[model samples]
Target: MLNMLGISAGIAVAAYGEARFDAFGVMLQLVTITAEATRLVLIQILLTGATPPPAPAPAQADRDVEMGLLGGESSASRPVMKPQPGS
Candidate 1:
């Protein structure tokens, strides 16, 4: 709320300065004021504890592999390979 007020005040001052001085300095001051207000608003939002969206659910294949590993089950019931004496 205070940020909004500050921005409004800055705009009013800039308008007055433009009417009186008609110089580039007033435009620069207005830009600086706008930038500061934006920075303050961002900081206020951060302080208010904004959070990111939740992650997506795991895929079906990934869930199944996880469950199998936890349950001590092999992916396939195949015989173990043995080494030959010579190639």
Candidate 2:
């Protein structure tokens, strides 16, 4: 809600600036308004817990490596070290 209000205020200010200026102020304000609107939309999406679609599944080779990591097998193929005698 606050983000929406901020975006609305920015647009209102931009409109006022455009009306009062005869130079490039209007163009700059338009850019500002657009940026603010974009920010507001992203914020709203985040606050609403919107998530991007899941990525496609990995290839068979990639999945196999990932499984090996989780299955207690190191991908580097290094032998596990044993504990030595304590000091």
lDDT of 1 by residue, 1-87 (tens): 999999999999889876887558778989999999999989988999877787545664576578687985444433688998895
Residues 9-49, candidate 2, lDDT per residue (tens digit)?
99999899667866576678799999999999999999999
Question: Which candidate's TM-score is highest?
Answer: 2
Show model 1 residue runs off by greater than 4 Å.
Answer: 1-20, 52-87
* Global fold similarity of model 2 (TM-score): 0.43
Model 2 pairs in collision = none
**Alpha carbon lDDT at 22, candidate 1:** 56
Each model's lDDT comes to 0.78, 0.80
